[model samples]
Target chain A: MNYIFHFGDMWNARGEFVEGALMTLRLSGLAMVASLVIAILGALARTSGPKPLRMLVAAYVEIIRNTPFLVQIFIIFFGLPTVGLRLDANEGALIALILNGSAYTIEIVRAGIENISQGQIEGALALGLHRLQTFRLVVLPQALRIIVPPLGSQFILLMLNSSVCSAISADELTSAALDVQGRTFRAFEAFIVAAAIYFALSLLFSTAFATIERLAFGKRISR
Target chain B: MRSFNAGDVVYLLLAARWTVLLSLIAFAGGGLVGLIIALMRVAQARAARWFAIGFIRVFQGTPLLLQLFLVFFGGDLIGVPLGAWLSVILGLSLNAGAFLGEIWRGSIQAVPNGQIEAARALGLHYGQRMLRVVAPQALRTAIPPTVGFLVNLIKSTSLAAIIGFVELTRAGQQLNNATFRPFLIFGLVASVYFVMCWPLTIAASRLERRLALAYKR
Candidate 1:
């Protein structure tokens, strides 16, 4: 109860904290883009691809969804090196994040795709659009609208989940906070600062996503 | 220099007991606290609602890893030093409570207003109305998401390892370090988690379908 708060110690380590924050942003950004691509493909495959491909995607989603991301990170960071696919800690962390993020994203995107009315696809076909063109022009646009909100939340969750990457020495925000705590012996201050930074980052990302949602879909809605 | 053996698998399984224990503590503690939070979120008092909102925002917005770190380490900075077991349990419970409260709040709200009015017209008080009418309906909607969160909570108990709890993930790390066989060790680790969680996932979906059937015309 008598402990004095030491914001000064954390302030002095601002550079390290900022660098760590950027690393977090970088990791989540890369994972977000990669997962979105993979999710689109996975959703497509699950929805209309050959039977085995759909089953494969289903298995991937189930396994990833059921397991903890901490174990997934360890499996990628430690287990992959044994298979002659060695990657450094950051690379391993990024790949783990992508794999984990994509599974959830695939489910969200698949739900969105399935929610699209069958009539729309039929209409596109009747208009002489090929299957690919129908999917691209008719199905995808409507699906993206349904998918955006959940996708935004998923991306933010990915950003928060990236904290676990520090388990494998990824040098992100949580790791940087630990390093500062180790060096300064100000565990409370170091973590408080890190938590605040994470809070700010989440708010920033959510606001940016809101803006993107508005700009991308604002015109179509009658609100 | 050593290879993974049956003994290592046994060691990992033994350590899994801590994971199960930690998860149960989190779920029980979180359920108790989360019910309070969910009620507070729906409470008529503005202060109670705001308190619930702020609690949910802080807990949900930050990483569980950071929360674990803060509780374990911050305990020492003050006069109270929490052991790893207590800290991990406290941390996960707080985090899980926030999420469960949010989920339950949504379910409670999803219960139709007509039901509430009907209960009021029957001369039921707030507590009676909630316990007898509202909660029963909300329970149906809440089961699937609650189970989903519980599954996530069980998996997240692995984070207890970071604070030196020697749970399942940490046990895997120690074994892998000794055996230097990452594939077998970590793959075994993942399968253990899958075995623990996959059944709950199936149960949640089945419950959702059952609830849907009850409402079908």
Candidate 2:
């Protein structure tokens, strides 16, 4: 092998790389919150709403879960404008991430909710608490504990997935690498840098999640 | 631009064959590499265990797309010169290896200690014990998740499009470019994927449920 390594060019592109990483973080963070909200509602409806609503949530989860995110990106970014709705690439990427993330999170949150026994909800009701109050007070805390570990991993997957947004030319770490690689023709060094940043970010997030899991839910075993 | 037509649908379906072919190659390669990594993760030697752990960490911690990018371009830069086909196969296999290794390791560990101890007491070697006893049991647990990962693998092959592999999604992209029917083309691409994946998803769940029932019995 006669390939000479040139990471010097990569080092020179640090600003763009940092900006891209921050873009990834921003894209993922916003998607996480938005999807969590949607998942919570979706899960609630799936668990206890009308049959049609439950079926709608079920279909949503199944369809989104089955399709590739890349296709979803094309549909949103390119297809929507054809239907008289238009969103810029970043907006479309964010929406796609939110939609995709919610399907899985809805399932996760639903499973967590299901883990709460019927008796507890009954007990909360028998205590004369309102239904919403019963949910917020009696159900949510325990459900959150059950859901955190999976939610953490799912969020990380979502973050990793936002890398796909680069396909639509949204400003993210992977795209930053692509831009530099295009300019410098240093594909290997550029991708390695991006991949390393991703690795570090993943480790950082997983470690943080593990700590949160331990501190917040380790001692309490809800019966 | 030519209008979207049945011929385009046929073209898209034909391209799906590459997606399936790539997935199968990765599945086979991943299974082989994964088996070795799983064994290493469960091995008695510290170095073997650590190597397996590090392999899993690197592969799993990074996005699969970046792995594909690295292998696709990194190979050329390093002078190995793997083209898109071989690079995607190698990259997906390695990534799948890490995930499947982790899955199978859990399955291997879940084997009762008494079973392994008895195999040892019977004077069976590591290969004999793992092959004859541990693997049979582990295979049972591994099958559902293995199938589950295959669905993930199939969906992931779409990322090969970004690297310019003309699989199902890439074909959809090409059709969309020509026909300007992103909704029809990409939606059709998604449906093709959904059809390919949903059955496996169902089968995986069914297998999981069956396994759970077996445990109860």
**How does each model score on TM-score?**
0.96, 0.97
Which whole-number lDDT from 0 to 100 does residue B79 have in model 2?
74
Clashing pairs in 2: none
At residue A124, give the lDDT of candidate 2.
96
- State, as a TM-score between 0 and 1, how close model 1 is to the true structure: 0.96
What 10-residue stretch in candidate 1 chain B is worst by lDDT?
Answer: B72-81
Pairs that clash in candidate 1: none
Displacement of the residue A148 alpha carbon in candidate 1, Å: 1.0
Model 1 docking category: high
Go through the candidates in order and give each one's DockQ: 0.81, 0.85
Segments of candidate 1 deviating more than 4 angstroms:
A219-223
Query: TM for chain B in all models?
Result: 0.96, 0.98
> What is candidate 1's lDDT per residue for B1-217, written digit by digit as tens?
7877798889999999988988999999999889999999999999999999999999988999999999987788776899999999999989999999999999999999999999999999999999999999899899998998889999899898778889899999899888888778878888999999999999999998888898894
Best by lDDT: 2
Query: Candidate 1: DockQ?
Result: 0.81
